[model samples]
Target: MSPVPDHGEESYIGSDRLKGRKALITGGDSGIGRAAAIAYAREGADVVISYLPEEQSDADQVLEYIKKSGVKGLEFGRPP
Candidate 1:
C-alpha cells in the first residue's frame, strides 16, 4: 500500500450543493457508494446506505464518518 487510496474522505469540498437533500446509496459499505455516503453527509444531507448483513462492519464505519458531520445516517441490512 505504497500510496494509500483516496475515497474523497479528505479531498471533497462540499458546499451545500446537496444541502437539505437525502441520499440512499447501495453497496455503500465500500467502493464508490462509500465515497458518496461520506460526501453527501458532509454536504449537509441525510445519508442512508444499504448493505448485506455481512457487510455491517464496513457500513458502520461509513456511518460513523457521516455522523461526524452532524447529519442523519441510517443503514438497511438485508440478509443474503
Candidate 2:
C-alpha cells in the first residue's frame, strides 16, 4: 500500500498557520464558512460545518468545495 503523506511536507495555507488542529465552522454552509473550509484544509486542519436547514442548496455547494479541499464536510441543521 502507498504511504500517506506527512505534515512536514505540507505547505502553509494562511499567514496565521493552523496546523494539526480541527475546526468546527459555524454558518459553514456559505460565505465565510465556505471560504474557511477550504482555507482550513490547505492549512492542514480538519473541518466540520454547521448551518441552517433551509440552505441546503448553498450548503451542498459549500460541501462540494470542502470536499475538493480534501477534508470531510459535515452538515448540521433543522427542518426549515
In terms of lDDT, the best-performing candidate is 1
lDDT against the true structure, each candidate: 0.87, 0.65
> How does residue 47 of candidate 1 score in lDDT?
96
Over 4 Å off, model 2: 1-19, 78-80
The list of candidate 1 runs beyond 4 A from truth reads 1-3, 78-80
Tens-digit lDDT track for model 2 on 1-80?
25742222134345336666788888876666667666776665667778888887877776666566566666676464
Q: Judged by lDDT against the true structure, how good is candidate 2?
A: 0.65
Worst 10 residues of 2 by lDDT: 4-13
**In lDDT terms, how accurate is model 1?**
0.87
Candidate achieving the largest TM-score? 1
The ten-residue window of minimal lDDT in model 1 covers: 1-10
